[model samples]
Target: MKLGDVAKLLGGRLEGDKNFEIEGVSSVENPKPKTLVFCSSKRDVERVKDIKQVALVVHTPVQDANCVVVEDVKYAMAMFLRIFYPEEHPSGVSEKAYIGEEVIIGEGVYIAPFTYIGNKVVIGNHVKIYPFSYIGDQCLIGDETVIFSGVHIYPRCVIGKRVRIHSGAVIGADGFGYYIGKEGITKLHHIGSVVIEDDVEIGANTTIDRALIDRTIIGRGTKIDNLVMIGHNCKIGENNIFVSQVGLAGSVKTGKNVVLAGQVGVADHVSIGDNVQVVAKSGVANDLEANGTYGANLPSIEWSRWKRIYLYLLKLPELFKKGS
Candidate 1:
């Protein structure tokens, strides 16, 4: 692809040789000949100033190197990758893949070797189930969804169109619900299923448990990161971004555009409103209102307040000795 063509595709202005060829994409800090790099911020622009050979994706046209100026660098990167680095999948169902009786397999569906589809399963068109995946009985996989290698989908789970479940992801597993009875600990069986809507991506090794009664719903366009644990009955809204190692207790509800950073933990039954941003390692114990940035220590205080308190605490021992 040419540098000028990339600008046209991104709907951005170009300020470079239109005939310059671009072979690959890389970060702004590192440039190779014919490589395309991205400059999302002013700092990135400064970093790109020293480079001369690469094609650049920028928020504004600069005179440094060949540039494609767009409104959003990250969004443009995603779009460019879709064109240049399309995903690869095997074609057709393998003979070693097992399909149970009465299963409905759609046209162009790719079932790799060692995949097991249980009874009455309905797989949609162009769906790719990689090798060693186990799709349980009565499961419904929507069109263009990709279940990567070693993914385990328990019975009756409904995965929507364009959903991507990465390798080692386990869906519809029993929730961690138990009772201490007179005899011993009694395991409560999960009777519900998981409903993942369109365009959601579940990261590698992330486990979403089934509810005790109703459904565990992951809303449309939500992206969950690797090793995140979502408990039973959690209702996650659309376009939410959950970073790695974030844990949500059972029955937690989150509104749209919520951002939970890495290692954030939410307690049971907590309701987080729309556009709430929780910083990394924050512990949320209660319900949070909309349009706020929360972070630090216990109870998830406002981000600014948390920073102030944390700084004050660092001086506490000095103040105590001076008082003595």
Candidate 2:
């Protein structure tokens, strides 16, 4: 692709070398010849200023370099990646795949070898189920959804259109529910399913548990990162972002556009309001109001300093008693 064509496709302003040939896309850290690199910061521009062979997609033009200046560099880079590396999956069902009785498969579907589609399942158009994936009985997978290798969808779960569930994701697994009876601990059987709405991307190895009696819902456009654990009956709202290793206890509810950072833990029955942003490693124990940023975890410091602070905290009770 030419530099001018890329700028036109990205709706960016071309600064120099309209005829420069961009054969690939690369990062600013490792510039490659004839590749287009995106520089969103001044430091990134400075790092690649001396490199003459690569074209740049930047917020501002660099002197004497072929540049395509865009308002949002990351979005432009995403578009470039989509164009350059379009995903290609096998189209037809493999002979080795196991299709059970009464399965309704749509046109243009791809089922790889060793994949198992259980009885009475409805798969939508252009859906791709990779090798070793298990679609349980009566599950409904919507159009253009891609279930990667080793993904296991439990029975009767409803997945919506354009959803991308990465490798090793386990949907509709039994929630951790138990009761302490007079005899001993008795396990409560989960009877409900999971509903993942449209355009949601579930990362690798993430698990969403099945509800005890009702649906555990993941709303539209939510992006959950890897190793996330969403407990049963979690009503996650639309466009929410849950970062890697976030753990939500059962029956927690989050409003739309909420952002839970990496390793944040939400207790059971807590309700977070719309547009709330919780920082990394925070523990959310109570309800959070809408449109606020919250954090409770302390930042890392020197070990000696942390010990001094810990000592002060330990002595606070004695100091308070003496003051009283």
Candidate 3:
């Protein structure tokens, strides 16, 4: 692609060398010759300052270099990446894939070998199921969805359009529910299902448990990071972002645009309001107010200092008593 063409596609302003050929897009740290590199900051610009062969998609024009200046550098970079390295939409179901009785597969669907589609599964158009994926009975997979290798979708789950579920993601898994009586501990059966709405991207190895009686809903445009565990009956709102290792206990509800950073844990039955942003490693035990940033976990320190702080905390009562 030409430099001017890239700028036109990305809706950016072309600064220099309209005819310069851009072979690909790369990072500023290790740029390839004749490729387009994104420079969001001055440091990034400085790193590739002397490299005149590569074109720059930057926030501002660099002197003596081919440049495509954009309002949002990251957005421009994403656009360039999509054009340079477009995702493959593989068509045709493999003969080795096991299609169970009465499966309704749409046109342009790609089911790789070793994939198991259970009875009465309705797969929408252009859907791609990679190798070793198990789509349970009566499941509904929408159009343009991509289920990567080793994904296990339990029976009756509904995956919406344009959803990307990465490898090892277990959808509609049984939630942790139990009852303790005089006799013994009894397991509670999860009869509900999981509904992942359109444009949601579930990261690799993330687990979304089924509800107890209804649907555990993952709203539209939500992005869940890898290694996250969402418990039963979680009604996650639209455009919510859950970072890696986030664990939400059963019945937790999050409003729209909520962001739970890495390793943030929410207790059972807690309700997080809209536009709330919880910092990394925070433990949310109660309901959070709307449009606020919250954090509870303390920052890390040296082990010796932590020990001293622990000792001081232990002696707090005595110190209070003496002061009184």
**Which lDDT value does model 1 have at 226?**
99
Model 2: lowest-lDDT 10 consecutive positions = 45-54
Q: In candidate 1, which residue ranges exceed 4 Å CA deviation?
A: 298-324
lDDT string for model 1 (1-324, tens) is: 887788889998888888889889878777667888888887887876455788888887777578888889999999989988998887798999999999999989999999999999999999999999999999999999999999999999999999999999999999999999898999999999999999999999999999999999999999999999999999999999999999999999999999999999999999999999999999999999999999885666799998999999999999999999
Model 3 clashing residue pairs (backbone): none
Tens-digit lDDT string for candidate 2 (1-324): 789999999999999989999888878888889999889899998887455889889998788888999999999989988887999887999999999999999999999999999999999999999999999999999999999999999999999999999999999999999999898999999999999999999999999999999999999999999999999999999999999999999999999999999999999999999999999999999999999999899899999999999999999999999999
Each prediction's TM-score versus the true structure: 0.90, 0.97, 0.96
- The RMSD of every model to the true structure, in order and in angstroms, is 4.9, 1.2, 1.3
Worst 10 residues of 1 by lDDT: 45-54
Task: Between candidates 1 and 2, name the one with more favorable lDDT.
Answer: 2
Count of steric clashes across candidates, in order: 0, 0, 0
Q: Please list all clashing residue pairs in model 1, or write none if there are none.
A: none
After superposition, the stretches of candidate 2 with alpha carbons farther than 4 Å from their true spots are none
